[model samples]
Target: MSLSLVLAALVAVTDSATHNGRAGQTTVPAVRADTTIDVDGRLDEPVWRRAALLTGFSLYQPADGRPAPDSTEVLVWYSPTAMHFGVRAYEPHGPVQATLADRDRVSADDNVEIQLDTFDEGRRAFVFIVNPLGVQADGTKSEAGGFIPGSNVMPGQNDLSADFRWQSKGRVTEWGYEVEIRIPFASLRYPVGAPQRWGLQIVRHVQHSGYEETWTPARRASASFIAQAGKLVGLAGMRHGQVVELNPELTNTAAGAAAAPSGDWRYRNDAQLGGNVRWAVGSDVVLNGTVKPDFSQVEADATQIATDQRFALFYPERRPFFVEGSDQFNVPNTLVYTRRIVRPEAAAKLTGKIGRSDVAVLSAVDDRATTSDASRPLVNIVRLRRDFGRQNTAGILYSGRTSGARATTTSPAPTRAWCSAASTSRRCRRCRA
Candidate 1:
């Protein structure tokens, strides 16, 4: 078996307010809706009329901090189980950019995007995109400072595979176009409570002019702007039904080996089966288990490497098995790489919070090919974290690899672990007298 194993237990403690930026002062009040939203893209609904509006867009890409030449207005509202946003883009002069593409592939035309840090941590976000034609695109982003992904997406730069289950509707009017987006809370992760304040960033992409003006200024020279995004106040007292999902699949493969120098060969065909189960432990934690799991990646890995690079290149994880709850495993350096466990036969991962501590654990076995010179191995990872005092966190991370009867470990420093995006992040150790 060839495999990679990364396990982390993270305890995130931050003010949530001051960790990213001080000028992120934008705020929106919550609106309770008793009326149904038709989502026909015509902003004539009664719910939209009562929702608080957000305006005054500023540029961040193609040009930064410049006032948008065109007007864009956004409004937000929510029910107990879902969240909503309405967009009214005015273009009185001629035609507006619109495309008729399949779902989750709306980058060619002028679009409006929303980014939300549901956890309110300065680390990650769930991004959604919609074109004037009402086509949609959605995915997750890694924003743990220093490195960023898909900054200001254009035609070729966007990764359409980043998908999340959501809905949108839009229609062109004589004035311009109107859009409405509906996102379920089940599709998002949040701490259970009343009146929660989450981080938010609203972006308007002007195609012809190539403008990526956001609700708040996101400078290229600084950390991830989503972490520095504005505030969305009043998300409280919501309920999420228990979620259970089971995936079962089968595979067929044929291979042969030469029996003699005369070209005689022995060939055989094989059929394999497997399944996976996920049970959400309430709205806060998730438990997942698999039996001979087969995650045949439908899309190819996007590793467009050059022939002249000086060091070995590590590709990012695109397989679904490794993508779930990946945030808890982040470190500053390359200690545990998921791609190392390229083909996992069986694995289990658990993610959730216990009091003030956050934890994640992953265990996997690999009998597939990883390196040209080495055989596959068993992988195990553990991460535990607790947050206290300002935005600082202290945690421990350890990863081990075992093949046959031999094994080795990667340990953190006495005071702090080696914090690398390839590894993990900041921590302050406790003193023992």
Candidate 2:
């Protein structure tokens, strides 16, 4: 099939699923900033005064889709470097459940959240949330099959592990609470273009009353509520300057081992240096490479299973290189698991968009998951996906493995053999699990 035709089919499927929800999306124009935003949780500047307000909230909790009793006002403005928001959440009766929590630990507190589908893809979004005390929690959301989340308690659309640094501040006032948030363009990923139309949603969570409301009513029955969210119109002059990242890390450790239980153990030193580089090839593609990458866990996992299992358990990806954009891969049976690549000496990954299609490729060599030098192998994965209708994707995947488990092995030797296969797969993730 022609490339254009394939993309068209992808879009058709996605649009169909997303369109099943409400229609006549709310639209708001983001004004260009004329003055500075102080970010003190106060909207006293002229920038906010000139911004447009988006209101008309409806209840999503305590009722699937009922009218909200309290009032809310959302003002939006943007500059070349960042987007700004001024949110006023009015609560008349109850005391705000503000907490002095650490950064990225403020969601459970009485908070307000802004979900931006910067690419306007609906299935994916960058979520910025801040509590009344200004503590913040951010994450990424992926909606497959454009599924509307089943319940508020376990809203299945967000990957809270996907966090980024952004600016936010909030204050509890006499009537309610207000928030000011600034998200840098560099911290987000969006197609570079002007006159941009992005999907957006504003939500307020009241802890005292267990109230949930959205500026644009997010219906329960609709599978793709966020995908079918209100639109942010008139976005212009958006530029995510040259994307380049350089990260370097160093670690030193000492370990001791004894031949016998009572033998005096001798200590050995282990020191290593590692780093990675990320460079964007225009706005559509990103290239990442790492040398001697260290995939050590900073915090130990506390969750354990005592039962005998028929298959290996699943744990979320955490390594920086593998976690980013990891969701777009749709290889059948999840053939690509980063944790399996026990000790990847080096690795490279490329991800971007071509026309309406999503593409990702990864190549690495691990010397960890096998027996000895003879069986070491290389791993390569490629995924191409197209979304045509509401919240579904049709994609193709190719995986090549030289041998053994993902990476565990005895010696640090290079891989030689490789087996390859290609297959087609369909997946719908309407919300995060």
What local distance difference test score does each model get?
Answer: 0.70, 0.74
- Scored by lDDT, the top model is 2
77-124 per-residue lDDT for model 2 (tens digits) = 898778898888888878888989986677668888889987788777
lDDT of 1 at 394: 76
lDDT of 1 by residue, 61-138 (tens): 877766666677888888877888888887764478897877776667888988887767655677889998679988
Off by over 4 Å in 1: 1-25, 34-36, 62-66, 93-95, 102-105, 146-162, 217-224, 254-269, 302-310, 353-357, 368-376, 388-391, 405-433
**Per-residue error (Å), model 2, residue 315:** 1.7
Q: Which ten residues in a row have the lowest lDDT in candidate 1?
A: 6-15
The TM-scores, one per candidate, come to 0.75, 0.79
